[model samples]
Target: MESGKLLKAIIESAIDGIITIDNRGRVESLNPAALKLFGYKLEEVIGRNISVLMPEPDKSSHDGYLHRYQSTGEKRIIGKGREVRGLRKDGSTFPFRLAVSEVQYDDRVIYTGFIHDLSKEKEAEQRLKEYAAELEELVNERTKSLKKMLHALSEAKEEVSLSLLKEKELNQMKSRFVSMASHEFRTPLSSIQLSSVLIEKYAEPFDNPHIKKHVSKIKNAVGNLTTILNDFLSLERLEAGKVEPAFTPFDIVKLSEEVTEEMQMIAKEDQNIIYQHTGIESMVNLDQNLLRNCMINLISNATKYSGEHTFIEFNTEVTDTQCIVTIRDNGIGIPESDQKNLFQAFFRAHNTGNIPGTGLGLNIVQRYAGLMGGELHFESKINEGAIFTLSFKR
Candidate 1:
């Protein structure tokens, strides 16, 4: 009797809903959990068809399913758990998991069903899906923002690189300017000072030959100063876009002769300038002053770089469509490595280490030639000789 009471107490207090049905499918007993799940009182549901707690089509077809099982002794949902819908007394439907089992009595069989509500589990699963979608959208937005930041950083880096490059170029130009001002200006200034002192010392004794020699030295120093000043001024004007070439008809051969004669005064001792004219005509249309400056630069370089007594050739040829001048010198020729930068300002050759120059002559000459619609090219072999050719369209 005590064991029976204990079993009754366990079933009454169980959390899952439990119900018993007879062989005829009539409700034999209902637990407190089952009454609460179906919203029915013990007396109201007892002896009624157990299908009363089911939602349609199960409500209509469950009796048929039971009768088939009883006749054939075949098992369908017996001893297995399945998801099913239940009807409440308020005519509402709820989802639940149902497990059924059978017990054999002395003369009949009885069936018992266990029920568990699945409303909370379904609701929790739906909440998880919503959270996953929201997280994916947040991640996409963050990725887009990161890409934009990277693009902005790339642009900033490019701007910084350009700024540094411009600064480097400016520094290089300033250094070259300082070097030019120091070397070019000091040489002529020292020469003029020494010659003036010597001229003063010899003036008291009145030596003609000595006075004349010192005067010539002073004149040459002054001329050197003038040439340096002109170079600087021309560079400034070119950079400022203030120089324009004026072309006119002129005798190119006669101009070359005059320039050569002037350069001979400053030529090395015993050096001779060999002038040759091969063209049919000596006249051409060009910028006279600019042409003169270009020739002066070339002839001066030939004289300066050649040894004493070396013969320098100045040849001019005029054609129907062009005028060409060639200046060939037997001097220390340019090294192959230095030829590429020969026309760059402030660039001196490696072989001409002791040669006194500002390194601006060829650069200025090339620019002037370009302005006159002319071309200047050269060929040289180290320790042998060099030839410079200038051509202009008529």
Candidate 2:
């Protein structure tokens, strides 16, 4: 009797709802928890069909299922836990987990079912899903904001780079202008001053030869000043897009001879300007003024850089499609490091120390060559010699 009471106490005190049904499917007994879960009184539920506690198809088919199980001993919902819908006394339905077990006492069979309501678990699961979705949306929004910031930073960086490049170009132009003015103006001014002093000294007695020499020096200094002014003016015109090539057919050999003769008068003592023509054609269509300027720049550079008595070779090779002029001199050539910037405005080779120049000559010549659709190239080694070749296509 004591053991039977203990078992009854355990079933009645369980947290989960508990119920037992007889072989006829009538509710034989139920716990207080079961009564509270189903909203039923013990007297009103006892001896009633157990299907009254189930909803829908399970409520209507419970009798047939029990009859089949009793006749065949088949095990469907017996001895297993599964989710099922339960009916309340108020005709409402709710989800629950159920585990059913069968017990045989002598020739009678009984079934016991344990039930647990699942409402809280399902609600908690739905809340977790909502939180995850909100987190994903927040992450996506932050990522888009970050990408926009990066794009803005990239644009800012590009603007800064362009500003820096323009500033550097301006600085270079300013430096070149100052260097060119100081070097070019000083040379002619010095020559004029010395010649004036010499002419004053030779005026009293009037030595004709010495006076003529000083006068010639003064004339040459004036010419140097004129040439410097012309170069600067030409550069300004080229920059302003005002200069245009005037192409005309002219005698290249006669032009070359005349230029060489003029350069020889200013050449160093015992120095010679050698001129040679290899091609048959003497007359060619080209910009005579620009061609003469280029040749003068090259030949003058050679003579200025070389020592006294050095021979300067000027050779012209003519073809059906083009004319090539080569001016070679045995002189102090360009250094390896300075060769690349040879045609930049006011850029002089480091090896040209003590040589008087404005450093704008090669730059002007290069621009003139480009205007005529020609190219200038050179080969040189330090202290050995330099060869400058100018090619003009007809």
Candidate 3:
């Protein structure tokens, strides 16, 4: 009796509710904690159905749930703790966590349910989940903004690098132009001054041949000066965006013939300048002076680099929408590595190291070609010489 009293004391003192149910779903025993937790006394609930302690919807469904489990030999919440609702003696429903255990005692089946108040824990868990979700969204937004800022910073760096490169290129071009003008112009000017002084001092004593030769030399010097000045002026105009090209229709065959004839005097005595027109002639709109300059530069390059006795050929071909003028030279060809920088200003090929040039010739040609809506292209093999093609859009 003393042991029984002590056992009862232990059951009543337990923090968790202790309840035992029989096979018929009727409560067999209810401890003090269970009675107090459900707002019931042992005398009132001991013989009552366990469904009476459950909330309304659960009260109606508990029998079916137990019958299904018994028929199927399946356990639903037998060993699991899940959120549920409990009914107090006052008819108020409160949230709880429930766990059940099944036992066999002397040929009788019994179920013990352990109930825990779940309101505070559930509310805390819900708040934690909400906080985590909000934190994830904030982190994602910050990452997106960081990516955009990085992209913008990358673009700004690229723009700054490009601007610096352009400035460096412009400064280099100015320096080259200044050096070229000083040397090329001063030589010719000095010659003209000396020649004029000699002619004026010995005007009466000089014979016809001597007089004519001096006069011719002066004229040639002046002509060279004028050509240099024109090239420089054209470059300035192009740089200033002041060239309003007057495009007029012109015959391709006629233009080639005239360019070839003009270049005859400059070609080596043993070299031949051939102009071959492939098929019918075509007419295209372009600036005549700009096209002429382009042609002159190409011809001059051919004359300057070709073998003394080799033939330099000029050939033209017309397509549906484009015309190609090809100038072939048999000379020392450009190295493959140097071809990439061929069109750059002041860039000369390794093979033309000994060739005399202002280096502005091809630069002018390329500029004029761009102005006329055309392109200057070339192909070459070492020792086999080169073929420069001017492609003009119709």
| 1-394 per-residue lDDT for model 2 (tens digits) | 9999998899989888999899899999999999999999999999999999999899999899889988897764743478899999999988888988888866988988889887776665455445434433443453355345435533543454468775456444534543555565556456554645554454434344544554555555455555655666666667768779999999999999999999998898888999999978989888999999899989999899999989999999889998999999999998889999999876799988877665789899888999999998999999988999999897
Q: What lDDT does the true structure give each of the candidates?
A: 0.77, 0.78, 0.73
* Steric overlap count per candidate: 0, 0, 0
Error of 3 at 354 (Å): 2.9
What does candidate 3's lDDT look like per residue over 93-117, in tens digits? 8788788888898898888888777
Candidate 3: minimum summed lDDT over ten consecutive residues — where?
131-140
1-394: candidate 1 lDDT, tens digit per residue: 9998999999999998999999888999989998998899999999999888888999999989898878898754743478899999989988888888888876889988888887776665454444434433443453355345434433554454468875455544534543554565556456555655554454444344644554555555455555655665576567657779999999888898898898887898999998999867988888899989888889888988899989999999999988998999999999999999999866789888776665788998898889999999999999877999989998
- TM-score for each model: 0.50, 0.49, 0.47
Q: Please give the RMSD of candidate 2 to the true structure.
A: 36.1
Tell me the TM-score of model 1.
0.50
Ordered list by TM-score, greatest first:
1, 2, 3
In model 1, the Cα lDDT at residue 197 comes to: 55
